[model samples]
Target: MTSSTRNRLFALGALLVAGAGLAYVAFGNIGQNLVFYWTPGEMLAQGSKAYGPTIRLGGVVQPGSLRWDAAHTHLSFRVADTDQPGAPSVPVLSSETPPQMFRERIGVVVEGTFDRSQTFTSSRLMVNHSNEYRPPKPGDGPDKWKTTVSAPTAEAR
Candidate 1:
């Protein structure tokens, strides 16, 4: 091969190696960063493999479910699908302070891992108020009060 061709080939090989290295770096870290969400039923189905893997538990906050220690600031709660009638739920324990919106019947996303005893130890408590805002009714208008209406007086001349 000529000198120019040899240099061109060398550059092409370097570019290919750089591209492969970049691809590996990008894809290799994805599994570590991505978190999977699962319910108690699904986690039970997967058996012990689900243990020690960081994941999010998505479910409803069970009513009257929070028990917190005022002095120690320790807290615990149960999560379930409130919409599904009589569905069994999972218990979550956390030492961190829960979000303000974290209440019964609300949707929550808890992140952590489980142990051999099947207890889910949550490190983070994220309340999900994922509902989109709806505009007020047209005629039943946005304003709560009637500004145009006047209070009745004794004499209007």
Candidate 2:
């Protein structure tokens, strides 16, 4: 090939290599930031394969399994895939305060790593509130809905 042709071909090859390098770096960064969501059952099913890396654990907070320190800084709870009997549950530990809407039987998504002890140590906790809203049924008292807002007391007047 001619000298000019050779130089043009070399330049084109360099450009392709640079493009590929850029694409590689972009994908590497994306993978590092990506966090996969898994349920307790799925995580357990993965066995030791799920131990490393930060992930989001999604499940319902098991009733009567929630415990919090008197200072409210440390919290522990069990997350179950299903509320039905015989369903498996995963224990979770967090140092942060639980969300305002967090309570037993509510759905929660916690971002953290699973330890060798089978406990998930969460760095972040989020309450998953449902978007659906339903009105109170007829003949039901206001107290039936624990979330009903109470009126102001006379002492505040």
* Top-TM-score structure, candidate number: 2
Deviation of model 1 at 28, angstroms: 24
Model 2 per-residue lDDT tens digits across residues 1-157: 9999999999999999999899987876765445456778888998999898898998898877777655656788888897665577899998766655677778999999997999999989988788977776887854552342121121112
Candidate 1 root-mean-square deviation in Å: 12.5
lDDT of 1 by residue, 1-157 (tens): 9999999999999999999999987887865546456666666677778888788887886766656554636677778856365676788888777755455577888898887876789888887787677677776664522321121111111
Off by over 4 Å in 2: 1-36, 135-157
Span of ten consecutive residues with least summed lDDT in model 2: 148-157
Rate residue 85 of model 1 by lDDT.
51
RMSD over all Cα atoms, model 2: 8.9
Q: List the pairs of residues colliding in candidate 1.
A: none
CA lDDT of each prediction against the hidden true structure: 0.71, 0.78
TM-score of each: 0.57, 0.62
Runs in model 1 lying further than 4 Å from the true structure:
1-36, 83-85, 132-157
